[model samples]
Target: MTYPRTRGLPTTRRTGQAPRAGTGSGFLFVMATLSCVIALAGTYYFFVRTTTGQYIDESALVEAATLNGPAERASTQFLDWLPVISVVIAAVVVLFVTIMRRRWKAAGIALVACVAANLATQLLKDWFPDRPFRGVQTIELNSLPSGHTTLAASAAAAVFLVVSPRWRPLAGFLGGTFAVAAGVSTLVNQWHRPADVVAAFLVVGAVMLPAGWLVLRTGNRWNVQDGRGDHWASSRLWALLSAMAGIASAAVAVYSLIRIAPGFGQENSTTNYFWAGVSLIVIAGYLATVAATWLFGVSARRRHAL
Candidate 1:
């Protein structure tokens, strides 16, 4: 079965050379991955090793505890089944797409990245030392790079990489929402701090970005995209919506932190930092989705791809 090649990407003119798509994307992927790793280390250093960082992080979790009501129970229930939920949904969708599109190699690539991301998270958790007693009575269980969040984010990422550009916008949106919701749930249930979720997002991005570069290279024949307006799922509107949401959430995070800064050490938090942490997660997850979507869309175009 010959895969339909789109007239989207350019081939070598009269040279009979194979099209080189997104070589620049490869470099960008490396930079993005390095950035993620550095950010993870930074997040750990500040949130787990510093007094103020621990205090603020712990403060958010503490404030979250004060909201003792149905939300707590709901988050608990959601987290309890998150592992299974992530596996089943990701497996079903990815498997269906793989079989339908016959994207065996692409599926294999995505699977490796997914497994690698999750495995890296676990290794980091074990390798990292316990949180130091930073003047705060914090739990020193090495729970950085939360496993639940890694699972959810990687699962969503795998689906995002598997689908064609035609379906990416919708897939990215839904997948991002799932990841953000999962992260917020962990915080609500007090299972992991905000930094843990953020770290998980970074890990997934680090792994998935390289895998996406490979997908574009190996599956260039099928990765063709006309334009953002070509399909509803491929619309820039989806990206705009995600960006708008990200910007709004970022503002909320900044505002929350600013409001709590003047009296940070002295005053006990009244759900300020908690919302801030949640805001950070939302922005990170949503913005990453938007970035990845834009990268693929641009890379598939003439300037980046051959």
Candidate 2:
């Protein structure tokens, strides 16, 4: 027996079912997950293991402490209720998708991954040693993989997972921004260091990438769509905007550090390091968003198997 060919995708004579789009999205996702893990490890080592990393991190935190007034007040308020707010938003979005779209398996996978990411973060916090006194006049508490950041990023990842393909680009962008806001807020209020927030983002990415792959595989009925042009939200504009923002933030971070390099060895800073740290959080959040958006966008089926 033989199967008719469709869209240049070859099918096995025995099974007669062509692979999903003949794309290497699964390989890309696995590579992306490994990259996330490696990035997390590097972040932890540099920030917690080395004296130079410690100084830069401490400098950023100390400079942030000097910032006050309306922005600080707003960040504090946002963090004070971050847990409740994140949970409510995630729950509502997940419930609506599962009930309305009937994405039972995908929803279960997403929710499970979300809980797992948060739990892993807490465990890491407990397991990691306190910040060693490498000549930096900072606190000794181990704050890597910030809990607040994990909550926000994982909540956003959950919503991103259950949404249909057409909305993923927009959902990813909005979700990334929310997570970035939570991270920057934590830094502004001294709740966490820059590395801690970035580590949290990596943790969510590492967990959700695999879960998202599962979602694409199982939710094929709804995941199939007419591509990005089919919906305004799925427009390539969202990913482009995110990439542009990430690039701009990266440039600012490098420039800030460069300007302050000549003034280094001094014991004081002028908010340069703090802005750099904030820029890092922004870069990581949006980088993950754009990567996930592109990965899912390509990995999802363009049309159902005939």
Candidate 3:
């Protein structure tokens, strides 16, 4: 029952004790969910309540709108096709899991998670209080969660959830990149603000983390894959890429936010804020993806040992 160590991921220590059911991933899921909720709440507070938040949003809109006309038009066109692209990707992943991997239970859990995330997005968008005027020229309604971003992120998350642990790292990195690109496209098209995109990432992660555990809880055998020798999809390069991207994007976001703090009300330059928003989306998307990869990777190894 020994698992070949693959790519520096965690493996079970030689102990004579049995592992508890749901201990590994269950804790991870709860923590991940709570973090997402906290993020959503904080995003709402800053984006809706604070004057600086309003200014940031206004600046983002203006900056996004000021892109070159051809680039803007192309972004809009790309965003319009995003839903279709997401659906196609999700379908391909789900089919691959169900047919090649024969992971019916995992596929079901992934789909349910996908539906729940999108439904939660609609519910939050409708029931969340409208944004106060805040003396900003932005839209009045609460667009805390971007529906397009939610669709894209959740779809990518579904694909990530159903894949085998050996493949999760690569799946996570690629899926996260796709989701982030979709979110940035929305911003470039001026279809949604930065907080909205970040919120969407949180929402998807909140729902998918638990669903991932559920998939593992029921499909332990299928979750156990040969991690020793495999394709690029099972390599650690994706983990490295995701970690580096997350760290770099987070640094940029923190630096940009700090720099823009004292200059908010002075000059009317939003380029910094715009870059900050994009950086936030990158951090959110990649961090969440890597977290999932680690969480489920541990869960799979632990369950396999048991």
Q: What TM-score goes with each of the models?
A: 0.91, 0.90, 0.87
TM-score winner between 1 and 3, please give it.
Answer: 1
What's the candidate order when arranged by decreasing lDDT? 2, 1, 3
Per-residue lDDT tens digits of candidate 2, residues 262-302? 65542345898998899999999999999888778677643
Model 3 ranges off by over 4 Å: 1-23, 225-231, 258-267
Better of 1 and 2 by TM-score: 1
lDDT of 3 at 18: 36
Residue-level lDDT of model 3, residues 130-247, one tens digit each, is: 8887788878878879999999999988988787777788888888899998888889888889889988998888888788778777764556544453577877788789889989
The full ranking of all candidates by TM-score, starting with the best, is 1, 2, 3
Position 34, candidate 2: lDDT: 98
Please identify which of the two predictions, 1 or 2, would achieve the higher lDDT against the true structure.
2
Range of the 10 consecutive residues with the lowest summed lDDT in candidate 3: 15-24
Candidate 2 accuracy as TM-score: 0.90
- Candidate 3 lDDT: 0.80
Clashing pairs in model 3, backbone N/Cα/C closer than 3 A: none
